[model samples]
Target: MSVTKDVAALAQPVIEGLNMDLIDTEYIKEGSKWVLRLYIDKDGGVGLDDCQLVSEALNDLLDGADIIKTPYTFEVSSPGLDRPLKTDKDFQRYKGDMVEVHLYAPINGSKLYTGTLHDRKDGMITIVCEEKEITFAEKDIAKINRAIIWN
Candidate 1:
């Protein structure tokens, strides 16, 4: 398995035990250094204490497992307000919220769309934009994320 997947598997229980969902895991190199980032979330939200707790526990588990050979910095944090909606559960949870969708190719001369996420069913997502309900196949989407409207 890939390093990210391996680390995610090892970290899943630790995060879940703390009553948080593991949003995602990424292992990437930055300036010749490897970084392992874990995105976690829960109802209401996540806080620094949650991140620190998960980080400490995962650090111990990863150190004991010796999963990665090279030196890497570990980080645990929230996915943030504009985080991508990656799974069905995420789509369901964010129903009725505004979202920004980027398509792999332009549809009707547009590659970007901002709308209210109406529903997700059978590999398709329905969004309401300008009083019209538009549906797009999940495969055609390059990215779909919550649109944070800043005041």
Candidate 2:
């Protein structure tokens, strides 16, 4: 297994046992700190205690494991209200909902698209913005999240 995969594999069991799903994981460096951001979730929602429990358990495991050699900060938290959608399945689940998408490349002279998520099937998303139907490649989305519109 790849080193990153190996680390994630070792960490998955512990996360699952705590009744949390790993929404996302990032092993990155921020200036002097290597931050391990573990975005976790549950069925209804995630709370403070959920994050605390996972943080404590993961810390204990990390302390015992020799997987990471650099000084890093471990952050365990909910994906939040505006959770970033990273997969076609994510778009599928939130289909019929509104969303904001940022693309790696401009589509029809626009890199940002915001509209009602009208479609999510066969690995593509159709967002209706201002009576115009804009299609985006599932892979080209750099960042996508459920849009919070208070209306």
Candidate 3:
């Protein structure tokens, strides 16, 4: 398995024990440093204490496992306001919220769409855009994120 997946596997129990959802994990090299970022969340929101708690526990787990040979910075935090909708639970949780959808290919001459997330069922996602509901197969989506509305 990939380092990201390995680290995520190690971190999952620790995060869940504290009642937080492991939203995503990324292991990447930036400049001269390798970084392991863990996005976590729970009802209402996540706080610094929660991040620190997960970080400490996960650090111990990683150190004991020694799965990563290279030195890396570890970070645990919330998935912020414009987080990506990665799971069915996430789609359901954010139902009625505005979202920006990017498709793998253009749908009706457009590759991008912004609308209120209507529903996800039968392997399809429905979004209400411009007073009309547009349904797209989930496989056709490249990315779906909560829209960051200003004002």
Candidate 4:
């Protein structure tokens, strides 16, 4: 298994027990250092206290678990406003919210779309844009991120 998956697997229970969702885990080499970055979230969003709590808890577990033999910097943070909608739970939670969809190939001469997320069912995703509902197979989507609107 990949190191990111390993880290996620090891950290999942601890994160859930703390009442937070583990959004993602990324293990990457940044210059001369290895960084283990974890994205976490909760219903009303995560604050510094939440991040600190998880970080403190995971520090002991990770140190004891020795999941990484080499040295690495650990970080815990929120997924942010533009986080991608990856799972059924995410899609359901963001239903009726604006999202930006990027497709692998153009549909109607366009590869990008911004719309209200309508539904996701049976490997298909539906969105409402311009008074019309557009549905695409999940495979066609490269990503679906929550749309960050600026005033």
Candidate 5:
């Protein structure tokens, strides 16, 4: 299993116990430094205290688990507004909200789409764009993120 998976598996229980959802896990390198980033969330949102709590707990757990041999920085954070919606819960939660969709290949001559999220069902996602509902197979989507509207 990958380090991100391993760490996430080991840390899930603790995150749930703390009443937070583990949004995503990323194990990446930046400027020759390895970083383990855990994105967490709750009903309203997550704060610094929540991040610190998970960090402290996971710090102890990861240290004892010895999952990574190299030096790494551990970080716990919120999956901010633009974070991708990867789960059914995410889709349901964001229903009726504006979202940006990127496809693996162009659909209707466009690789990118911005619309009101409608629903996700049986491996298909439906969105409302320009008052017309369009459905796409979930597999065709490269990513779906909560749209950041400046106005």
Candidate 6:
């Protein structure tokens, strides 16, 4: 099995046991070191205690299984506030909120757009900036970060 799959199989139980969702996992070889990154989340948010719980459990599992077969670093973290806006559900939830997006292909004259997400329907995103509404195709979006609004 692939390292990612193997890690998921082992990590899922640890996450589920704590009543958390395993958002994502990545096993990467950077230079001579292998890095295992685990992204976890819960209903409202994630805290240090949650991370520690998962980390401790995952460490025990890794040590016991010896599956990695090499020295590596394990990192468990939350996706954070400015998490990537990937899915349609993400866009829908944050509609009317301000966001910053980077697109692979330049739209009009720029690749980065920061404005209010006027609406999102189907696979189209309409952003209202200044006085104009700019439309974007979902596939063209490279990365999107939610903009924090403070009253």
lDDT value for model 4: 0.93
lDDT of 4 at 21: 88
Q: Give candidate 4 regions above 4 Å deviation.
A: none
Specify the poorest-scoring 10-residue window by lDDT in model 5. Answer: 86-95
C-alpha RMSD of candidate 6: 3.3
Judged by whole-model lDDT over C-alpha atoms, candidate 2 comes out at: 0.80
Cα error, residue 78 of model 6, in Å, equals: 2.1
Model 2 stretches with alpha carbons more than 4 Å out: 1-4, 130-133
Better of 5 and 6 by lDDT: 5
TM-score-wise, the better of 2 and 4 is: 4
Q: For residues 93-138, write the lDDT of model 6, one tens digit per residue.
A: 6777789878998878899998988887777778888878988887
Error of 3 at 110 (Å): 1.6
Question: Per-residue lDDT tens digits of candidate 4, residues 39-67?
Answer: 99888789999999999999988889888
Q: Per-residue CA lDDT of candidate 2, range 125-145, in tens?
A: 789998888888888988889
TM-score of 3: 0.92
Better of 4 and 6 by TM-score: 4
Sorted by TM-score (best first), the order is 4, 1, 5, 3, 2, 6
Q: Over the stretch 1-151, how does candidate 5's per-residue lDDT look in tens digits?
A: 9999999999999999999889899999999999999999887778999999999988988999999999999999999989999977788778999999999999879999999999899999899999999899989999999999998
lDDT of 3 by residue, 1-151 (tens): 9998988888888888988889999898999999989999887778999899889888878988998899999899889999889987798789999999999999899999999999999989999999999999989999999999899
Compared with the true structure, all predictions reach lDDT values of 0.92, 0.80, 0.91, 0.93, 0.92, 0.83
lDDT, model 1: 0.92
Model 1, 68: alpha-carbon shift in Å?
0.7
The candidate maximizing lDDT is: 4
